[model samples]
Target: MNEPLAQRLRPKTLADVCGQQHLLAEGQVFRRTIESGRIPNMIFYGPSGTGKTTVARIIAENSGMTLHKLNGTSCGTGDIKAVLKDIGTLAGAGGILLYLDEIQYLNKKQQQSLLECIEDGSVTLIASTTENPYFYIYNALLSRCTVFEFKPLSAADVERGIRNALKKLSASEPQPVTMDEDACAYLAESAGGDLRKALGCLDFVVTAAPVDEGEKHVTLGMVQQVTRRTAMRYDRDGDDHYDIVSAYQKSMRGSDPNAALHYLARLLEAGDLPSACRRLMVCACEDVGLAYPQIIPIVKAAVDAANMVGLPEARLPLADAVILVATSPKSNSAHDAINAAIADVQAGRTGPIPRQLQNKHFDGEDAAVKGQNYKYAHDFENHWVEQQYLPDVLKDVKYYTFGDNRTEQAARAYWAKIKGEDKL
Candidate 1:
């Protein structure tokens, strides 16, 4: 009778679990994996509030295996060995399903320690990570587990989950939480494909006990009142933290604002601090660059705001920065140019620096050695410079392909006009 709302609302069967259409569809490999009954060692990778734990539970309970659960944060090698000793001799009747929640929290040695046990069939792992396993989990241990990537639960699933939770709550208490269609969508939107967050929200809504069960229906306003979250557990200092940022950057580069925002929001909501916001400043300038100069200043402002006022208050500025960067025009000419220059260096494209830039301010002879061939931009009427910046081996090589857009076109045209005197 004292069951938590989340537990009461948890999916009782695989059918009850939401999202993962790729895995849940009929005849799918994941579906087959589930029906296989003898579950293999697996790694479940995804963000928090997603269904990683839920799916692992389904796997354990549904399998004919005996369940053994441990938090990786608290678990040590001794605990693992004890579990392994039991598992090494476990019979078919005593099949073991070991669920390691937040397995990424365990250090490298701890992860590697389980490698032998898993390989020897001493333990069947169901390790869960809110980050990419390849980065957090040891390659040895990861190789032993069948990696299954879990996606966020959809809004529809969140809605269905809410309705079912209301039904279950009604079973215990005479009254249940009520919500209208738009209210449901709003809750789901706030949840952002996280069933746990949705159910936790529903639980909060019910606890609030809106007395007016009459035509005064549950609306988005009520849902917003109930679910005011400002923190997430994902640590920003770690590698996984950068991984999400990278995903957000690439997503923006790939022109997917939805995905970029999703990743960006996850980082900020997870308590990703000012430093991450600072990194975004470079990303905006270097990646968006001249293509969307607006992003540069906005990102700088966001970083300054975060530094001046820290989080959870800092999240607003961070979110604003992400939205600005994500929505801005994107180009990778700077990135490409750097890579091309590096390629030239590797390919023996060695030459002295152009004369104009050769430490003109410095008095030494070789100081200008690096800037030997540089031309003066202020010499021409338009203050344009026409000279070879690259060494002889790389002189003919051109990097920095412009994006086919208004901003890039203007930039390329200016670059061409400035450097056109090299027709010789």
Candidate 2:
């Protein structure tokens, strides 16, 4: 009778499922597929506690097919061969639903073997992964499966799940557990859109309560005792690590200090200072380039200081760097300029280097060398000279569009004054 609360309250039918209305809602194609009892090879991808496994199980139950579960991290060629062997006998009657959890862990070789099963439909492949399928799963295998992305459950859905688990506990135990409204809300919100985590917390609180009879009432204090400060669910080496760092950089680029700091705190808490520092440096140059170019050195200095002094103290300079980048005038002209030039080269626009601009520093090289025609800008007024710096093929091409920021506007204006026009 001592079952984990999350398992005990797992949604039996799709209707019982709480979140994922985008896919599970009425008239959705996925919903229709599940109801028709004719499921195709599918890949469920999302964060933890997002009901990917639960939905796969629901499909298995509704499809009336024998469910063969495999952990992708551990299951090998032998396991797949055994399943394929079983499919010959068992799948002939009702077909088979193979639920592979953590499918990203399946190496390229294992995935190649699984591709055979998918192609022949020996078993209806239902793979669930926390990592992005497009990034981790093999392209051949991914193309064969319909991907459904599950989002983190909303606060309301998590609250509902908490209430349902409490009801189940009350129905089963003589001394029903009662949770205060504030305590329930706190637990649900602190779960951070993770229903299974909420249920587990509730179970732990109810089980460990120091009560021998009657109803044990849970309060906010008790909830905090079990949930602590609700650590920011981050994995230092996993997809979450990259995801949070990406968010941090985007937040800085988008000029949102609030989101930048939020992601920064998460990174620091997860001990991912190196990623945080790297992202800030890139953001400073890529997003704030030329507009407020001084910020680049500032960010680099902050990063250097952070690396020299780790942790609690490191967070200070990081916070300062993030705030500075988020508040600075944003521009991507430099970043775009490089990319545009690279794209031209990639598209066969790579013209040879202008003879004048070619190196002439060799021992025997002299004014008669290929780059002898090079004009010295310092020889002219204002240290400015208009000459063909680019290759002949790209002479008319323009890159490095000036941003709206005053610093770049000044550069544009100065260029116009010297060159008689503003186009580069």
Candidate 3:
């Protein structure tokens, strides 16, 4: 069987790895540690194709440890035990390096089974996970391992990998395989930081390209044909989902329409219409509250339209909502007020409801006394009256502070006029 181009071009040394200069750059602590050949128990956390497995393999080779590869998706406690059984054999004499890929798939008990081996120095572990380690990892097991996050490769980094792959492919081909510069760039950019994906696309296009005058030519059209859509690394249940949603809301709250739309595009591209709709409604209320109170119902209509229409049409209403919220005058006064009131209530600072504010419907002997002094504000001028609505203990506490927006300031002026306060 033919080996995959990505596997054939896997980096054998740290110098050959495509990206992650943050961890593997010369003079860096991680690089220095790997060169020192005293590899520690560590976790490789990142998206796929960022060279975690490659780096782990390089470390094992340099350290002269007996590398034992196991994927958590396929390996269980019994498989772990099988590796442990070789602990005293000559095969394990140099120490065992267990490279557990997708370590998040292993349950707590399965993870616990390795604690003894790791603690005793019988096994040096390098676990890799695409998910956030803190959320999925067994805390005890996680504590024993140092985590190194691998970031997505930049277009330049991926382009380097593509160039290398082309060289290797050309050397093996009967006719020299060459790609247009634009094609190479397009392939690298479309891979979305996944070297494996870029290489795979390259492999397919090169194999399918026709030889012209003893030279195989890959054009920009060929690259486009192979990659109909750009690769996006988005897991609805994972970090990407939350991160994009957070960026979407924050961009609107920060009043950057372009950034808000960009994140909205990401969410929509991921087919996460529900999250986009939900967050837009939240941004309208939490970030644009009071300053644009009418926007609350307007965003609700957009959200309702989005859900009813669904994507590709869903993005239309959603984008309108995102822009409206992003461009609206911003305020968090209402959100802050509710949060402060909730905090006080949760902190047990709530005193009893005042007698006048209590329910007045009861027929008991004290029923008339319960709500006796409650003044009818409508009967008074300005449809307002001086009243203590908050519990006596919190009456002096100010929760709602008017935001400095025009709408809020106008309301502030009106209330101040009605209440006869000098300050607006």
Task: Give the candidate number with the greatest lDDT.
Answer: 3
TM-score of each: 0.71, 0.88, 0.94
TM-score of model number 3: 0.94
Q: Report how far off residue 401 is in candidate 1 (Å).
A: 6.9
Candidates in order have lDDT scores of 0.74, 0.87, 0.91
User: Compared with the true structure, what per-residue lDDT tens digits does model 3 show for residues 10-78?
Assistant: 989999999999998999999999888888999999988889989988887778888888999999899
Give candidate 2 misplaced runs (Cα > 4 Å): 1-3, 90-92, 229-231, 237-239, 347-352, 361-374, 420-424
Candidate 2 yields a Cα-based lDDT of 0.87
- Local accuracy of candidate 2 as per-residue lDDT tens digits, 136-220: 9999999999999999888899889888888888898778879899999989888877888888889888887766457877889
Q: How close is candidate 1 to the true structure, as a TM-score?
A: 0.71
Candidate 1 residue-wise lDDT, 1-424, digit = tens: 8666777667777777777878777799988878988678998888676678888898888777777888988989898777766664635346677899999899998888888767876567898988778878888888788998887677787778777876766666655446687877778777767778787777776776565753224677778786666223345656557777788777766667688777767776676665467557867877788787767777887789987897777777877777677677777777778888788779877787645556655446545244345556787778874566665556777787888767988877777776673352
Task: Please estimate how well model 1 matches the true structure, expressed as its whole-model Cα lDDT.
Answer: 0.74
Clashes per candidate (backbone, < 3 Å): 12, 0, 0
How many pairs of residues collide in model 1?
Answer: 12
Which regions of candidate 3 are displaced past 4 Å?
A: 360-371
